[model samples]
Structure formats: C-alpha cells, structure tokens
Target: MKIVTLDAGTLPVELIKPDYCESWVYRASTTEHELLSVLDNAEVVITNKVPLRRAVLEKLPSLRFICIAATGYDCVDIDYCRERGIAISNVPGYSTRSVSEGVIASLFALRRNFNEYVRAARTEWSDSDHFCLHKSPLKDVQDATLGIIGRGEIGGAVARLAKGLGMRVLFGERPGQSVTREGYTAFNETLRSCDVLTLHCPLTPETREIINRRTLSQMKPGAMIINTARGPLINEEDLADALISGRIGGAALDVLCKEPPAKNNKLISLPHSNLIITPHIAWASETGVNNLIKGINYNLAGYFGGKVKNSVI
Candidate 1:
C-alpha cells in the first residue's frame, strides 16, 4: 500500500517506518497547494496537523485510511469522511502525563512568583534596601483551590498531582449549567472560587471562547489560568485585556488561537510579565512522542488485521 505522511516536522523525531507499506513518502511540511500533489495517489495518509477536510480528501482518489498523529482530530471533517467511507483513527491519552505535568509546572512558576523573582534578581536584588528584595508575593501551592475544566484523562491526571500537593480540586460542569452534578461545580462558581484554573477541554462550538470578557469578569481577581488544551477555549484579546487590566493574575498558554501567531496577534504584541506563552510544546515530551508513534502503528496494524484500533469513525 502507498503511504504518505504530511507535516512530519510536527513531531520532534522521525516516525518508525511501517514495513508493510509497499511505498512510503514523507514531507516535512505540506501547504494547501502542496498537499494536492503529495496526496494525489496515496492509499494511506498520516497527518499531525495538516487538515484533511472533505475539500482536500475528495480530490485524493486513492486515499483510504487516515491516521491522525494527535489526540485532537478537529482538523478532519468527520461527517464527510464517514459518508465517504474513509477510515479515521487518532492517538488518545498518549500525552496525558506530559500535558498534566506541564500544567503543574506552569502553575508553580506563576503562583510562586518565579517569573517576577527571576527578573528582579538580575537588577532589583543587587540594589535592594534589605538582604533580599521582596516586591512580589511568593505563595505556596498547597491548600489552594484548583478548578479543572473537562475532567478527562489529562484533567484527571492534573487532579491527582494537585491533590498530592494539598490542593482542593473542583471539576467544572458545562458552562451556563443551571444544575451541577455532585462532583462538579457550576462553571461560573468554579471560576469565582479557584486560585488556579486549567483547561483540558476539546474545541467545539459550545467551548470556543469559553473564556472571554464575561467569564474573566467572574473569576477571582488574582486567579491564574493554565491552558494546555485546544486554543480558542480562551479569547486572546480578552485574555490580553484581563492580564493588562489586572483582572486576572497570570496565564501560561501552550496553544494559541493561531499557531505560530501572526506578528500583530494581540497576545504577541501585548506586554505582560505575568503572561507566559510556550510554542505548544506541552505534549512534545520524548515519552509522549513515542506513545504517539506506537499508537499510530497499532492503528495501522489493526486496520490491516480487520480490527481498526483508536478509531474516530
């Protein structure tokens, strides 16, 4: 079978070669026009973030199976693929630990005043009136309330880690829910109560811009937000405003509404010492990457063996 992998650069390392394929081709990055040529006659396609919606998939006459290299398969057009009989699979729960660990690390850095102290040590500490410069507050992670949105694999992992540090955890119910379950708090109530809030939800119409001006206004004055989930969960302009106006204390975002944000993206141009933005590397740990590779191979093997593992359709 002919196989083509588009945007292999999304993964930090090379994927294991599938021995069963008769032909294999890999592209470091594939653009819209470029994908047309690369996928023209492929029986199988492996993509990390290069979308394969109906517009792109319809032209590929030979395409049969699609193996998404990540847990989130939002890029694919599920309804069209289902109607067209294109098999789809994804790697899920592969990055649970890495993403959860990243959230925990960011929480400590933001709450414990690590960013402020690091900058202050270079200049302010040298000219301090006392032995140590203490302009920024250093707070302990323990005994704080941590509110988690979408308590799936990664969120559950975060809850376990936070509880170990003595944090009181609250799982949030859907936004605007009139009644909450026994374990879940009303979304707005969770926002008002949390010392730290982290997102692990999928991106959908109901969840897009879940954190905006109205929601930010409801949060505690100095609450922190850590987003290792999909972007668009929080509105960038609203978040920038919240950070600048001191409505929220801090934020660490691994993903953005736009990847490799434009030069003039609101968050990129905004100046805020409390806001930390990493280039979506929360799930790029070596172990996580390996798990993804294994997941893909397992799916590929299952498809050929009449089982089809980790399918979305």
Candidate 2:
C-alpha cells in the first residue's frame, strides 16, 4: 500500500510506518496549489491540518483511507468522503489531561498577575521602599467561579481540577440554547456570573466568533477569558478592543484564528501584561504527544487488520 503524510512537520515526533506499507511519503506541508499533485497516487493519507475538500478528493480515485493526526477532523470534507467510500479516522482524548492542566495554569497566571509582577521584579523592585512590591492585585483561586463552555472530556477534566482547587465550576449550556440541560447553567447567566470563562467547545458555524462584542459586553466587567479550544471561537478584534478598553480583565489564548499569526494580527503587539498568547501548545505536553502518536499507530494497525479503529466515517 502507498501512504502519504501531508504536513508531517506539525508533529514534533516522526510517525512509525506500518510494516505492510510499500511506499511512504512524508512531506513537511502541502500547499493548496500542490495538494492534488502531491496526493495523486496515494492509497492512504495522514494529515494534521491540510484541508481535503471535495474538489481535491474527487480527483484522487486511489485514496482509500485518511487518518487525521489530531482530534478535530474539520479539515476534511466528511460528507464527500462518505459518498466516495473513503474511510476517515481521528485520534481523540489523547490531549485531554494536557490541555486541562494548561488551562488551570493559565488561570492562575492571569488571575495572580504573574507577568506584571515579573516585569516589576526586574524594573521597579529595586526602587521599592518596602520588603515587597504591590504592582498588581492578587486574587485567590479558591473562591472563584469558573464557567466552562463545553462538557466534553477535556472540559470535564478541567472542572474536576478546578473543584479540587476549591473553585466553583459551572458548565455553560450551548449559546442560544433556550432549554438548559439538568446540570448546566444558562449560557447567558454563566457569562454574567463567572469570574473566569474558559472555552472548550468545538468550532462550528454556530460557534465561530461566538465571543463577539455583544457577548463580551454581557460578561462581568473585569472577568477573565481562557481559550484552549479553537481560536476563531473568540473574535480577535473584539478581544483586543476589550483588553485595551479595560472592559475585560485578562485573556490567555493557546490557539488563534490564524495559526502562526501574521505580523499585523490584532492581539500580537498589544502592550497589556494581562493578555497571554501561546503558540498553540496546550495539547503538546510530553505525555500528550506520546498518546497522540500511539493513537495514530493504533488506527493504522486497525485499518491494515481489516477493521478500522477510531473511524469517524
């Protein structure tokens, strides 16, 4: 069998090829223009983020199976793949622990003013009159109310961690969902009451740019926001404006609308010590990466053994 891995560079570690494979091609990345040409003769393809829409899939008659290297399979056209008899699989739950921990870490950093104090230590501490410097107000995590937007594995994990730290966790129902579930708080109510709001939902048409100006206005003044989920869930321009206007307390984002964001990205150059932006590494802990690679290998093995595992289609 012939196998091609598009965008192999996204994964820090190399993928182990199945022994039955006849040919394996690992390209760093496949641009839109080069996608069709590169995947012309492959029987199976592995992709992390390179999109495989109908236009590209229709031309590749040889393609049989696709193993998405990550949990979210939004990069592929699922309906078309099912129609074309193309099998689709994805690795899920591998990064649940890693991402949940990262969210809590970010929460502590933002709430306690870690960055501002670090800056003060180097620049302003020397001129201080007292033994300690009070550059920014520090809040205790114990009594804070945390609002989580998703009820998936990672979201549940975050809730458990927060509760252990003496926090009150509220799971928010879907936005505009008139009927709230038994254990969930109304979406709007969660917005108004939460001390810290964290997003763990998927990116869908209904959720894209969900945190716009109007929604941000509904949030409690000086409340913080954390996103370890999809980037586009929060509107970047709106977030930047809120931070600049001092309406929102702070924000820590592990994902952006555009990965490896451009120079002119609204939040890139903001001079706020309260805002923290990471290069989408919340799911990249050492254990998380190993679990992800193992999941991929398991899926590949299942495919060769005549029963595909983690099959999404």
List model 2 lDDT by residue over 1-313, tens digit each: 8899999899989988789889999898888889888888898999999999999999999999999999999999999999999999999999999999999999999999998999999999999999899977998899899999999999999999999999999999888897547889989999999999999999999999989999999999999999999999999999999999989999999999998899989898999989999999999999899999999899888888899899997
Stretches of model 1 off by over 4 angstroms after superposition: none
TM-score list, all predictions: 0.97, 0.98
Q: Write the per-residue lDDT of candidate 1 for residues 1-313, one digit (tens) a residue.
A: 8888998999888887778878889888888778888887898899988888788888888888999999999989999889988899999999998998999999999998777888889968878888988866887899999999998899999999999999999999999786447789999889999999999999999999999999999999989999999889999889999999999999999999989799898887777777788999999888888898899899888887887789998
By TM-score, the best candidate is 2
Q: What is the clash count of model 2?
A: 0
Q: State residue 64's C-alpha deviation in candidate 2, in Å.
A: 0.7
| Cα distance off (Å), candidate 1, residue 117 | 0.9
Q: What is the C-alpha RMSD of each candidate to the true structure, in Å?
A: 1.2, 0.8
